[model samples]
Target: SCAVALEAVRDEAGLGRTVAQVRSERERLTAQLRGHGWRVLPSEANFILARSSRSVWLRDALAGLGIAVRDFPGNEHLADALRITCPANETDFARLTHAIDAALAPEAVLLDLDGVLADVSRSYRRAIVETAAAYGVEITAQDIARAKALGNANNDWILTQRLLAQRGIDRPLAEVTERFERIYQGTDDNPGLRMTETLIGDRAALERLRARTRLAIVTGRPRFDAQRFLEEQGIADCFEQVIALEDGPSKPDPAPVRCALERMGVSRAWMVGDTPDDMRSARAAGVVPVGIPAPNDTREEAERTLFASGAARVLRSLDELLEVLPS
Candidate 1:
């Protein structure tokens, strides 16, 4: 019976205008979050699930500020999500606003597909190693890493070929390209590539950008594969446009990034990616190049790599974007 009292508060009906006041307060909090560029998911219930790359950090920050918020780190769909009960008072809302403003992103962001936005350690990179072994090339993931470290390289096919050559396995370029494409594209029955990827960026941040400014994808992947990944994550619609391999020459050529910006009709924007090619493309296109190197970047080598590629800013993860975006 004691628990019933707690449950009652969840749906407690009040005087005629009391419900109206609560709804008004909820809208106020939502608007406040939206104002600071947060994606406030629609909530018909008493609580809202706000997605952010810094969910854990935000939750901890709020708690230290004398407020409690529930963070769902267990749910893959909501790993970087926070389920917060609507603020009960203006004071609470004020505190929430302060915490959120501390982290945000640029107005418009063009994101890279594989390494920058998604975790490819077990997906794309793994596929590279597996495909190489399947072709009797026998290369380690480190080989792939070393190849990626070289800036101004975008085509994975080229990277694979270079790695093989370094290992004394020189073969016809066309042959290597064929095998790589076969493994990456996959056979119908085999489902060829694992692509066991996850969003390394904040869904909430992306949503906020979408609601306010332009958010798009400029990737070297074929259009079909990029769409497949986006559709699977239910975020295909998040981006305003997608410029894939089918759109033009891949990164480092500057075509894809230019295509994205042209499609979005924006002259100035931030190009965010995890490779030197991404940095080079942004620079070539005259946009602000923001680089996020491999997730396993050690000794800040990735940072150095991006900087060398003319990246205006280099970050470790998408989670850090909110904190590092230029004002």
Candidate 2:
């Protein structure tokens, strides 16, 4: 029996995002497509019908990977247009992004340390909560998240201090700084919070990426922290150099990104990162800024945030590098 069709424009509201959010996302996606050398048309609906000369080839390629995209060439104007339905949620958006990247392929990849190559939620975020609670301040994860949502939080110590001040409780810079360092870095007896860090990507995957093209680490972490993470995580062999916070001005300025590329002796590099500052910095430095769907953010949210911050692409995982870049 044939199933009866429902009314039009149904489910105008999505599970996690609204219709307007879908529109916004599609607009950003269209721009991203155009940025990557695809000829994209202005879309009015949640779905985008983009034009690429290799539309059919790419469509079949994605289909082979268990991903479906509509490529209809019977139409006159849209001879090689590919119609892709927008993802319903943030998570699916990231998956869609990965699929597209795998189909398109990238040249070089720059990496972000936290939230991309490593899960720092337990280590860094936990340290912030404990440090704030030590000063008799009752702060929740949601509160800290909101505080970080404010732009320019590359320095956690300064961020913590600002959050404390926002609560009308002003402490000496030294007091807040020392307490945060003690809990975050830990002493000989304390074991420190560094042990809480964990690798998010596979070692072999990174080795594969390194083999593909040049690799570097551009992070907001301090020099010692960056050094410890690279060496301890056994990923030091993966990158040519690390431009940490102490190396130059924090992100959104492009100084650190430029520093890394200059040190690596590369003329151009593609940047992979989780934060808006990372994207902004990459854009300013003339690097191709690619956003990562951070574990902490919804895929749609990360995509939108990064695009707004000038990212050209969004990726699901660093491991996907092996798939997104051609051998």
Candidate 3:
């Protein structure tokens, strides 16, 4: 898939290559495809879908020979063609050729963001503290830990208000909310406040996975904020689609997961994250849930929680994810 290949290129290049080189390479590839007697279709994308005018039905032909290809339910234009991928290596390209000739179909791959792609908890915690302080109310570390542990649900706001009430600190809810907004907007107040952590092992594993699979970002963080972080990390283009909290309902609810699947045009996918909420969300959406327990979490506790929450598999580190995902 061009999506997958481009992700690899981006990861390797980090958005520093010249536009001319990129364009020239694309043109050269197009010419080569044309030379092969392939009726290359116009693509604003990295890959192309092609069909032979010959009697063979591309999908059926691929299937008859035991190969799989991506097919959308309602797109007529793509209905008869095989979605070919641009493989990153000679071995991969050779495999692709064999699969194409043998007519094998391809499987759709989905990726999870947040804990799977970045560490966002630290940034989120700082935001919570700063937001509370902006309201002229100081919240104890206990409160922050409680809210985060309780799924960070919007209902926490009500609990916060109650806590303030008990403290004899009366403030309008709207005023308090406005202060929270200000803190979120003023991200520079804490230069190090980031929800995502750069785990080198995870980043490398993700880069390897992107070489073949169509990746998506399904996260509980708001879309705008998530995008900002992804762009900052130079990995925004790695994902074909991103489904964030603001895109739909929160986790433990199926809406956001479903939204991610819809955007990625995938039915089956693996949902990976650290929290039980992530597992519950995947279950609600009918997807496989994989848990990557926090390294700092005690092994017994992580195992207990992940198993109790119905994780299909528990990974101790991001590097382990590569073992499960397709190379």
Candidate 4:
């Protein structure tokens, strides 16, 4: 075994390359741990000595997530410290960082795009109104809000069709969807209503939150629209995952929320959203459901509906999340 190990080293050049890779990864790991609020000691070795007040909890949490780190339980000198080996490969290094981030933060945040992150009143809601109006049915913002509160109206096209049918004007799903898409995505000669959408909350605050925990989007929007909104807002990099309609069944089904969690390699997370469907989906996925009313939603009605649908907590605004989220 000693002779085989020596042969694997392949002499001074190979050994030097291995040493450089270890040191590079170590530096990156130290910086990541420090960013997660751990007190990482300077090291000249292939591992990091990091201290956290919840070192034992972190150790257990990482272990639950299938990552292991050496921990000192009773030693007076290092009871609150963990010794983590540096991962030489990028994939393992990312897994370690994500595990550490999840352990310290306790839960990553899953966000719904339309109403929670972006104000969709002039885009999606307006599309619904116009699509209904084209069929001679007048739908108000309050009507849209009411439809969303139903919890089964996760997809906007289906919601629009329902609204039209309720008004005694039945339209084919395909026809209603075509009108909705034309209005939302716009024609070649005219920009789509999607251009009217705007982001809610402070971009800086969102970036700050993303620094502490992994962020993901689990939205009913098509994947293209979701990516376009994130890119247009210049906050695309803030999210680690985007689970869109194309990915699976829309919210209230829980499949999309669970899909996001699976993609993130996490089992614990908070889902921030605006509608009852979002709340139900998050809760069904065993995620902590946090609610924020859409700009167009009636506060009392929205809050009542969200709470009734299994929301763990409801916030006045997305920015308020900074105050209540675990540090």
Give the top-scoring candidate (lDDT): 4
Ranking by TM-score: 4, 2, 1, 3
Candidate 2 per-residue lDDT over residues 26-113, each given as its tens digit: 9767877786678887777878988877676457445533457877657877778999887656777766665566456643567879
TM-score of each: 0.62, 0.68, 0.56, 0.68
lDDT of 4 at 11: 86
Candidate 4 local lDDT, 277-319, one digit each (tens): 8888876665667788888777888888887776656788766
What's the C-alpha lDDT at position 189 in model 2?
A: 86
Alpha-carbon RMSD to native, per candidate: 17.2, 12.6, 18.1, 12.1
- Tens digits of per-residue lDDT, candidate 1, 278-305, equal 8778767655677777665553777777
**Model 3 off-target regions past 4 Å?**
1-112, 133-174, 187-192, 195-202, 295-299
**Cα lDDT computed for each candidate against the true fold:** 0.70, 0.74, 0.57, 0.83
Whole-model lDDT, candidate 4? 0.83
Per-residue lDDT value at 187 in model 4? 93
Worst 10 residues of 1 by lDDT: 98-107
Arrange candidates by lDDT, descending.
4, 2, 1, 3
Residue ranges of candidate 2 with Cα displaced over 4 Å: 1-107
Please count the clashing residue pairs in each candidate, in the order shown: 0, 1, 16, 1
